[model samples]
Target: MLMKSSKLLKLKFKHQLLMLFMALLTGTTMVSAQELTINGTVVDESGVPLAGANIVEKNTTHGAQTDFDGNFSLKTSSNAVLVVSYFVSFPKNQTTFKTKK
Candidate 1:
């Protein structure tokens, strides 16, 4: 009976350690999936800031418009494709940027 009890205790300890490791791994994965903020300025060909420019994540509703100084910030996944455009009268462009981990 004594030997059996010791074996059971060792088994329980190992199980607890395994559970803790799995929990930590899961937490890290969730943190990595958290949203990221991207910031930048929109400029025209003449090197002038383009205010009110439309910035959006391709194929998604996540978007933002440039402020008075052509600066804009939006939250999205770490890997996202952005579509930047001016008014309908102007041209449109697409850009892809990777966020740092």
Candidate 2:
């Protein structure tokens, strides 16, 4: 009688282990947030695309600047907290990023 119970316990344990394995393989038990991408263009007060406008992600080391066409691309985990600065333009502090759709 005791032997039969022990076998049942081991079978239950094996089934639990199998369930865990399947969950890991299928990512059913785990989920992650979607990443964000920031695509923007920098312009001056005159509405002209400002080339070389410095765009830096605040608190983090990642950064990028505008090209000659004033276009820039940045990637982050979510809504990017950025610092946009340029010699010709006012220093933009704590700028909220616009996520691309």
Model 2 ranges off by over 4 Å = 1-34, 98-101
Candidate 2 lDDT over residue span 7-28, tens digit each: 9999999999999999886784
Q: What is the C-alpha local distance difference test score of each model?
A: 0.92, 0.79
Tens digits of per-residue lDDT for model 1, 1-101: 99999999999999999999999999999987777889999999898999999999999999999999999999987778899999898878988888555
Model 1: lowest-lDDT 10 consecutive positions = 92-101
Pairs clashing within candidate 1: none
Candidate 1 lDDT for residue 43: 95
Clashing pairs in 2: none
Model 2 scores a C-alpha lDDT of 0.79
The predictions' CA RMSDs to the true structure, in order, are 4.8, 4.6
Candidate 1 wrongly placed segments (more than 4 Å): 1-34
